[model samples]
Target: MTARETEWISIPMTVDVPYRFAAGRYLTKTLTQLRDNGRIFAVECPRCRRIQLPPRIVCAQCHVRNGRWVELPLEGTLVAFTIMFLPLTDPTTGKPHEPPFVYGSVRLDGCDSVLDHLIHAEPDRGKVWVGMRCRVVLRPPGERVGDLSDIVHFEPLPDQSRPGS
Candidate 1:
């Protein structure tokens, strides 16, 4: 066969296909309280004073059990953000979503960390950046589960500063 033909025939038969997958872990009773109750909880490391979200059973920083559930505020600033260009399929629904979906790391008030979530703003490539304020959009009161997905994407808090001043 010609070189071009040989190259085509020698191509690997199996192409790696990457698709969205649903991943979850069964939470124990203690961790489950945050999701089902719409309350934020975190573990405060006694040694370092770092409040880790998702209330860990052990403290990774100090290598101890200096962790306990602590309530956290729902509103926080957007620490960072990105606009996805490729279409993403919702793992729950298994369908391709429109491109330009905004996602960001929101630093919930009173928590010394950030939780990555969706953004409820029209994603402009030029606008997304660090330190933009965002707030959690919680699920309906009656419908909540102890899961990261329980809190929907963050929405840009209203800009209280006067527009032209």
Candidate 2:
């Protein structure tokens, strides 16, 4: 086929699907704890000793069944982050998060996996950064549902300075 003879076609369509999710054994336990007791739980791999959030049945690292349930401290380090300028839909709530917000990945104390969520900080570069210490903020016990949305957001701890600033 010659380059000038090519035909381009475009189609536009929208599909809407709604469904409920079954959290199953491991995740249900984790979400339930957060909702009921305001606690975070992770599973530890017997072989590799890797601690994972949203507790999984098997360890990704060692391929062994994860059994030990460890309670993680709410405090963690903000290992990565970004100041978002666009309004993005929050999948958990099916709502649009307002623009000029902050989002980041937090590595909770003692857990290997990082949980990504909104950061309750000013949308300014000077206000947020990697290595910033943060703590999980959850809704009041009665208001919390058994889901990741139980966490309102991660708030940066006070009295800290960015490295080499």
Candidate 3:
């Protein structure tokens, strides 16, 4: 074998590299609240008036420490989307999910940022589009987990018409 090929295989896939992460001050308490109850928590930066999802301890825009917690709306509008061809079993239900699942970025109402979530739309190429309205559907009563997946997936809203012509 050439030196290059020999060197490539010599590297170990497993390593003792230290995993370093910025330890937050209050993430544990914040996560506990969410896991115990079905609530979406975010931090509001007093400086920029921007809310950070996942409840960041610091504001990314102004680098200021956020002091207030805000509960955001679960409903949102689909801003972008893509179809995934990968098929796999869902972790919660040990059952296989259908392929061609739609993943989308939804801009939550009353927030400046968008949250990515799974969409439950059919895989027909002609059906999905940007700016489509979608809303969160919570999991069954006994299956709540307080994670984003607690909401099964976003589905297109039904077309409601006016009362009279």
Top candidate when judged by lDDT against the true structure = 2
With a 3 Å backbone cut-off (N, CA, C), the pairs that clash in candidate 2 are none
Model 3: per-residue Cα lDDT over 93-138, one tens digit each: 6687677889899876766778887898877656777877788776
Local accuracy of candidate 1 as per-residue lDDT tens digits, 1-165? 788766744455765667864322213432366556666766688888888775665677788775456678778887777888889887666787687899888888888878888988878855555776777787876677546667777877786432333
Q: Each model's TM-score? A: 0.73, 0.90, 0.70
Model 2 C-alpha lDDT versus the unseen true structure: 0.93
Worst 10 residues of 1 by lDDT: 22-31
Computed on alpha carbons, the lDDT of every model, listed in order, comes to: 0.71, 0.93, 0.73
**Where does the lowest 10-residue lDDT sum fall in candidate 3?**
156-165
Using TM-score, rank the candidates from best to worst: 2, 1, 3
lDDT of 2 at 103: 96
Best by TM-score: 2
The runs of at least 3 residues in candidate 1 whose Cα sits more than 4 Å from the true structure, single-residue gaps closed, are 2-31, 91-93, 125-128, 161-165
In model 2, how large is the Cα lDDT of residue 49? 89
Residue pairs of candidate 3 with colliding backbone atoms: none
Residue 86 lDDT in candidate 1: 86
